[model samples]
Target chain A: MSAIYKRELNAYFTSPIAYVVYAVASFFAGLLFVATVLEGDTSDMTYLFRNMTTIIIMMIPILTMKLFSEEKNKKTEQGLLTAPVNLLQIVMGKISAAVTVYALLMVLFIIYALIISFFVTPSWVLIGSNILGLLLFGTTLIAIDTFISSLTESQVIAAILSIGAGLLLTSISMFKNMVDIDFVNDIIDSIEMMGRYENFTLGMVKFSDVIFFLSISVLFIFFTIKVLERRRWN
Target chain B: MIEVKNLVKKYGDKVAVNNVSFTVNEGEILGFLGPNGAGKSTTMNIITGYLSSTSGTVTIDGCEILDDPKGAKSKIGYLPEIPPLYQDMTVKRYLEFVYDLKRVTLPRKEHLAEVCKVTKITDVYGRVIKNLSKGYRQRVGFAQALIGNPPVIILDEPTVGLDPKQIIEMRNLIRGLGKKHTVILSSHVLSEIQAVCDRIVVINNGQLVADESTEEITTNFTGMKRIQLHIDGNDNTVLMTLRDVDGVTRVRKVMRTIDGFTEYIVESKAENDVRKAIFRAMAKVDCPIVMMRNAEVSLEDAFLRITAGETQVNRKGGR
Candidate 1:
């Protein structure tokens, strides 16, 4: 598992995709910081975190689209699957690699917050909680995209499907108004990732919201392993 | 070293390998001979645990592959028909990854050096696999298989895309590996099987058709032996004289005129030596026999006959 992690991390650096993702996400975050913080003349990071969440939704798919799809296209998955390692380890290794990159992007937010401190006092507690929320949200996205990558051999298809799934999960709360039933509305609000993310950005770390993200990531990782294992028989 | 029992693999309703069972002993080179889509690769994939059998079990070194995969897989090294390689990675890093994936407990430095030396990929260690030539990439794949020093090695068409020189080198490497590791190689090339294999197992249409040694498969399939003779006479007289001889089953004129004489081929029934009978018969007819030699059956003929379902009748009739 560690070997896979190291290889994946090295692959990210060797190719231009990782740098491009970092540059694009950071560029968008900086632009959002200027428009949200400077224009409003407020120290609150609520708008910044909300906009960054949308940016990361696009970034995570690019980071994960080629994770398993390239392996299958190159026939390298045969070596990986037939190795002595189990399915869970391989999946975890890949997720951790993507998470590590996501974490690196999250660290850049600290610089943005520090710059905001120059003009007005920024709430370190609120900044810390929002960072935690973004990390958890990115984890779920990465796990889901990893599963999506396994479902096909073409990276383009994986990326498009991941973006579609991410969009649906994030905007699912809007569709709740269209439904008149209370039960359906309640289900959508609970499963809506953006709704769950709103608590952390408001400087309140809800236990239920944290559990939701953790469970969703775990379920998807489990599904990814099942998909890979079922391939051997099919 | 390896045992496969009733291994059947089906992709949906299409059966790929049907009731295929074979065993390889320690320190033996078993060649798998079959044409394309003959389930050679499918069987290799199943034995190596890359694919699951529909209704079968593979036992390697006393451990079942499905039940104890890690234990069984750790004892074998496999090289598929297409070498599974990460083209972007350098040869050194690629091998390092394989060592970790295989979980070798030995000292890494010495083991890698030895594997590279054996596969002759030491020169390309620093180059990326994508930039290397096809032969180098193949050697790198071979080196990856030899990383953990597994006791059993499976190579599927190791020399498929290599030139003649590279093919010979790969054969020598495999031959050297056979001294210590039980080797299972699959190829449709007849001469490769006859040259490198200790025993040959021929598969046709997902079924085992013939299993015997290299020499035995050739001689066992010789239902009727032919003797080619050059006679200094007309074609009809020589053909009629040889046809009247006892034990001569059929006679045909060969499409060649050697030294101003017509060549007639005489086939004998039941593997009998009819040269002396034909000699006396031709002497009586005053048709002088210029030259005579026996035409032996080769492995190529045996492969064609066995795969074509013609060997059954020949097997029942001949000893």
Candidate 2:
């Protein structure tokens, strides 16, 4: 598992994808920071963290689209699957590598808060909670996108499908409002990812929300392993 | 050692491999001979635990592939049809990654260097795989399979895209590997298998057609031996003399050369060597034989005959 993890991490840096992801992420995060912190003259990072979720939704597919799809395309998955490693190890190694990259991006946000600290003292607890929330959210997105990547051999299709899934998960609240039935609204409210994330933006670390994100990540990672296993029989 | 029993793999309603079974003893080079789309790769994949057999059992070094995949896979190193290489990595990093992936206990630098020397890719060790030529890339793939020094090495069409020189080099490399590791190599080229394998398992349309020693398949599968002769004599006397020779089934004039030599093709029973008798008869009749050579029955002929339902006869007659 460590072997695969190290190789995957090196692959990200060797290619141009990691830099492109960072550049795109920094562009959006910088834009939001300038608008929310400088023009509004506020030390509060709630608005910036909240808006970064949308940027993450758009940028994470780029980091994960080639996770499994490129392996299948180049026929390298045969090597990985035939190696002396279990399916869980392969999945975990890949997801951890992508998460590490996403975590590095989150560190960029910490730097933004540090820059704001010079003017007015910012709450470290709030920043820590927001970073933790973003990390969990980004990991869940990576797991989901990696599963989508495993289902297809083309990276473009994987990226498109992942972006579609991310947008749908973020917009579940809108669907809940559009429906009038109480039972259907309750179901949507329970599954809405963006709503659970709002508590973290306000510096609240809800345990249930944490469990929800972790469960979703585990479910998708399990599905990805199943898809890979089923492919061998096919 | 590897044992495959009643292996059957089906993709939907189409059967890719049907009740195929064979074994490779230690230190033997077993060649899987088949044409395209003949499930050669599928069988290799199943043996290496990359793909599952719908109904079968593959045991490698006492470990069943399905029941104990890690144990089975740990003893086998596989090189698929296309060399699975990470294009973004340099050769050194890629090999180090494979070493770690295989969990080899040997000293990393020495093992990798030895593999590179054997595959003759040490000079290109610093370059990225994407920039290497097809031959160099294939050698790197071969190097990857040798990292752990597994007991069994399975290669599917390892020399598919190489040039003539590289093919010979690859054949020599495989022969060297067979000294220590039991090797299973698959190829459609008859000469490649004939040159490298200790035994050949001919597969046609996903069925095991013939499994015999290299000499047995070449000698017994032909059924009839043909000898081409060029003689400088009267055509009538040459034909009459050759006809009286024992075990000579048929004799006919093929062509007349510009130098007054007549060419004749003589067919005989497979077990007989009628060359001496023909020479004596020709000498007695004063028909000087200019040249004589046996016309070998190629692998294509034997393959076609076996695939055309002569397997039962060949199998019974061969051993």
Candidate 3:
């Protein structure tokens, strides 16, 4: 697992996707920080975290697009598949590599928050809670994108489809409000990724919400492993 | 040692490998000979545990692939048809990754050095694999397969797209490896297998057609004894005389000269020595037998005959 993780992490750096996504994502984060919080007198880190949740809808796909698709497309999966390592090890290696990069992106947000400290005193609890929520949220997004990447051999298709899935998951909160049916609204509110995250933004870190995000991540990773095994048999 | 028994692989409705069984003893080089889409790769894939077989089992060094994949896979090194390289990585890094993936217990640096030396890729070890030429990339692939010094190595068409010089080098490398490891390689090129393998297993249309030693297959195929004759006579007269000769099953004129001499190839009914009979018949017809020699069946002809569904005839003389 470590071997695959190291190789995958190196590949992310060698390929241009890592740098491109970092530049584009950091640029958007800086733009949003300056336009919304810096230009105004108040400093609500929730706005920054909310925008980040949206930013990852576009950025997480770029990070996880080539995870399995590139290996399958290039036929490099033969080497990995024939080795002594099992399928779950390979999947975890790839997921952790993406998470490592996502963690780095979140660290960069620290710099944005530190810069905000220069103008006004921001609530440290809000910043910490929101960052925790974003990390869990980004991990779930990466896991979902990783599964999507496993479904196809073309990285472009993987990226496009993952972005579409991320959009749907984030948009579930909007659907919950737009619907008039009580049962439908309750179901959507329970399943919506951002709906669960709203508690964290309100400075309440609930154990159930953390478990919800983690469960979704594992479910998707499990699905990806099943896809790989099915491919071998068929 | 590696043993595959009654292996069957199906890709949906297509049976890629049907009840294929073969074994490679220790320190032996087994050649898999077949045409394109002949189930050679599919069989190799199943044996290496890359693809699951519909039925049957592959055991390497007494460990079943499906039951104990880690044990079986650790004993074998595989090079697929395309080399399965990480093109973006430097050759050295790619090999290091393979070493870790294989979980080699040997000293890492020395094992890598030995592999590089054997494959003759030490010079380009630091270069990116994508930037190397095809031959160099192939050599790099070979280098990784040697890492950890696995006891069994499976190579699929190792010399498919190489130049003649590189092909010879690669063959020599594989031959050298045979002294220490069991090797199974697949190729459609008849001469390549003839020069490398201790035993040959021929598969055609998803079935094992022939499995014997290199010499056995060649000699069995040569059972249809043929003689090339240079007779001093008219083309049609020499052909008819040879055709009528006792033990001569068929005769065809190969070339005719303006000075009333002709060349003909005469085939016998079975594995008979038809040289003396042809000489005596030529003397009787007053047509001097200028030259006569047995036509040997090359491995190319043998492969064609076996793949063309003539297994029974070839099997008669081969054990």
Candidate 4:
């Protein structure tokens, strides 16, 4: 597992995906922060993470796009598949690596907070709650990207499809108001990623919201592992 | 050391490995022979627990691959056809990573040193794999397969793209490994297997066509006893005389004007060797035989028969 982790982490940076992901997300994040909160008079850290959730949705695919897809495309997955390690170890190692990169991106949000503190007092409870929300949101996005990566061998397709799917899930809340059916509205709102995240970003930090995000993340990761497991027989 | 039973792999209606079964004894060097897409690599993959067999089982040292993959895989070291390298990594880093993946129990540094010493990659360890030649890349692949000193080594076309010198070196390395490890080397190149393997298993269309000791299989598959004749008489007379010999099945008089003597390639009937009768007959015809030899059946001839002359397509292209 450690071997896979180290190799995958190094590959992310070596192949330039990690740097590209960090630069693209952080640059747009920087711009969003400056335009919305940094340049504005009032500062809401939760407001900043809420806005950056879009950036996370867009950029998570780059971090996880090649997790399994590129390996299979390049035929190097044979090396990992034939290794002494089991499939769970391989999937978990890659997921952990993607989470690590995602965590690094969230750390950039801290820099945004520090700059905000220069103008206004930084609220500890507000910042703590926002960071927790950011972690849950980032983890779920990474898990979605991981599942997308397992679905295709072409990394580009994986990235595009994941971004498209994530956009749908993120805007599921908006679609609920647009649709007239009551049952559909309730189902859509319950499954809406941002709907569950709205409470956390609003500093409520409900246990149910945390559990929803955690469960979705595990469900997607479990699905990705199953996709990989199916290859042995196929 | 390894047992594969009724193994079958089907791709829709096309069977890749169809009910193939074989066993390798401990410390035996087995060779897998087959033409392109004949399921040699697929069999190797199933044995190494890389791919699951559709409807059968493989037990490596008593641990079934499906039941205990880690235990079974720990016993077998595999090198696929393409070497499965991370082109970005240097040889040392790549091998160290493999060492970790194999979970070598010895101290990490010591185990690495042992692998380097055995594979002779210590000097070139710092070179990036992409920068290295194909031969070096192959060696790096072999080094990884040898990392944990597994009892069984499964190499698929190990010497595929190597030069003559590297080919000899790899063969010698595998031969040396046969002293301690049960090695299964698969190749379409019969000479490669003939040089290294103790036993040979010929597979075609996913079926085990033949399995025997290397010499036994080659000799059995050759089917003809060849007699070379250096006759001083006319080629036509020698040809007719060979036909008159009771056991001679067929004769091809080789066209060689070497020092004004003739050579004949007289193939005997499957179970007959009429060398003594031919010698006596040649003496009677006053065509004194200068030299004679029974052409031993080569591994190449055996492989040609195994692939059913499909390899003759190469000759057609050459022509």
Enumerate the candidates' DockQ scores in order.
0.60, 0.69, 0.72, 0.62
DockQ of 1: 0.60
Q: Worst 10-residue stretch by lDDT in candidate 2 chain A?
A: A171-180
Instruction: Summarize candidate 1's per-residue lDDT along B1-319 as a digit string, tens digits.
Output: 7888888999999999999888888999999999888999999988888889999899999989999988888888888887889888999999998998899998998999999999999999999999999999889989988889999899989999999999999999988998999999999987887778888888888988777777777556567787888888877888887888999977878776747888887777655889898889989989999899988666676687688875462221001
Residue runs of model 4 more than 4 Å from their true location after superposition: A177-183, B221-245, B248-298, B309-319
Q: How does residue A109 of candidate 1 score in lDDT?
A: 79
Worst 10 residues of 1 chain A by lDDT: A77-86
Quick one: best DockQ, which candidate? 3
Which 10-residue window in model 3 chain A sums to the lowest lDDT? A40-49
Worst window of 10 by summed lDDT in candidate 4 chain A: A38-47
For every model in order, the fraction of real contacts preserved is 0.61, 0.80, 0.76, 0.75
Candidate 4: fnat, from 0 to 1?
Answer: 0.75
User: Model 4's CAPRI class?
Assistant: medium
lDDT of 1: 0.87
Please state the error at residue A179 of candidate 4 in Å.
5.2
**C-alpha lDDT of residue B130 in model 1:** 97
The digit string of per-residue lDDT tens for model 1 on A126-231 reads 9999999999999999999999999999999999999999999999988987979999998897789997898899988999999999999999999999998898
Residue A145 in model 1: shift from native, Å? 0.7
Give the winner by lDDT: 2 or 4.
2
Error of 4 at B267 (Å): 4.6
Clashing pairs in 1: none
Per residue, candidate 4 scores C-alpha lDDT tens digits across B1-319 of 8888889998778899998888888999999999989999999989988788899999999999999989988888889998888888888878888888888887878888877877777888899899989998898999889888899999999999999999999999999999999999999998889888888887888877777777776566577788887889977778888899988876877766577788887777568869889988888888888889888766676686666743222111001
* TM-score, every prediction: 0.88, 0.88, 0.89, 0.86
Query: What is each predicted model's overall lDDT from 0 to 1?
Result: 0.87, 0.91, 0.87, 0.84
Over B95-132, each residue of candidate 2 has an lDDT whose tens digit, in order, gives 99999998999998998999999999999999999999
Error of 4 at A225 (Å): 1.7
